[model samples]
Target: MPTKSLTHPVRTRASRGDIAVLYTVHLDTSHPTTGCDVSPAAVHEEYVVTRVTSVAADGAVTSVQDTRWSYDNSSRSLQDIPGVAKIFVIPQDRVDVEAALATAGAHTYPDTTVLRPYATMDEVCDAINPHRH
Candidate 1:
């Protein structure tokens, strides 16, 4: 994942060059490592946003911009979305967009990227790289 710190431009509003996060409620994964598991291991699966998109748009999403800060690992990889790219025309429904969004996390750094509420780097490292070993 990218830094948990907000870059301001990363607000959830799907704008050009903005990293839009898609919340996956439960994604079955075949992670390369056993310690990489994100499953709940019990009730509901974990809610996570792995991939992010830096969209390009005029009035609405038009393309995926190749942003340098968009990735650091597999989970933070940028997705190439053809449907919303400038090459294809998709209808915009502002009302639906408004209805679908719920802003979370505190904005910091600048209005360059919005970091969603997630575990801090130290917390994450502690979880994945447990001391039990």
Candidate 2:
């Protein structure tokens, strides 16, 4: 008997209208901490970034085809993978995040860090609105 059974299937595209918050962490452990000269010992530490998604106020449909101009353009899967189940995104609270990072000596770089921002809704509308005249 097979230990695994057919369960879920992969779809090429997401639903017509769906909002998602992608998460990623940067891992760096090259900090050095072997000095005793300083009063508190300025040791190196690692940082884990926790960024939130750009709020789509206009309810724009996000898709892989045109995400090249959005903050969530990365095709990297934040879900549906091995060991991913263990990871969880904290609540949407910057203060909490900062406090947590302060305790852990970490930080988050949402837009400017892991992902890049592309064409905004204003730009898209400006480009199309002017031409209709």
Candidate 3:
């Protein structure tokens, strides 16, 4: 039998004609701390995908916009994946994220650090929305 993967879904604030659902998965990693017989440290990472579906009063889905993001444990922050920014849905939040990433230079992920921003949600939505119409 194959193992089953679990995902959690959260409802986002919706407008009169649409309902948004966010689905999340947690990823875990363990690495040895130091020295002989030292216990490993467990780290948790998150991946989130959201679907904003436009619906009619009869509960029919007319359109859907999906987006995704990943958490960077070393930076202790969320990072948007390329072409998927609406998963966060805020512009100022990205500014704060940049500041946090800058201050997190002291931290290393496997001896290196990398932080960058993906496209804005509006850009992503615009690119994909054309296909839906």
What digit string (tens of lDDT, one per residue) describes model 3 on residues 62-126? 33333212343221122332222233222221123233223323223455554222223233233
Which sequence of candidate numbers ranks them by TM-score, best first? 1, 2, 3
lDDT of each: 0.29, 0.27, 0.29
Worst 10 residues of 3 by lDDT: 3-12
Q: Pull out the clashing pairs in model 2.
A: 69-118
Error of 3 at 26 (Å): 2.4
lDDT tens digits by residue: candidate 1, 5-77: 2212133235433333332232344533256555454222221212223344433332332222344332223
Error of 2 at 15 (Å): 18
In candidate 2, position 51 carries an lDDT of 30
Off by over 4 Å in 3: 1-23, 29-51, 54-64, 67-133
- Candidate 1: list runs displaced more than 4 Å: 1-12, 27-39, 42-133
Per-residue lDDT for 96 in model 2? 39
Q: Could you tell me how far off, in angstroms, the CA of residue 89 lies in candidate 3 after the best superposition?
A: 14
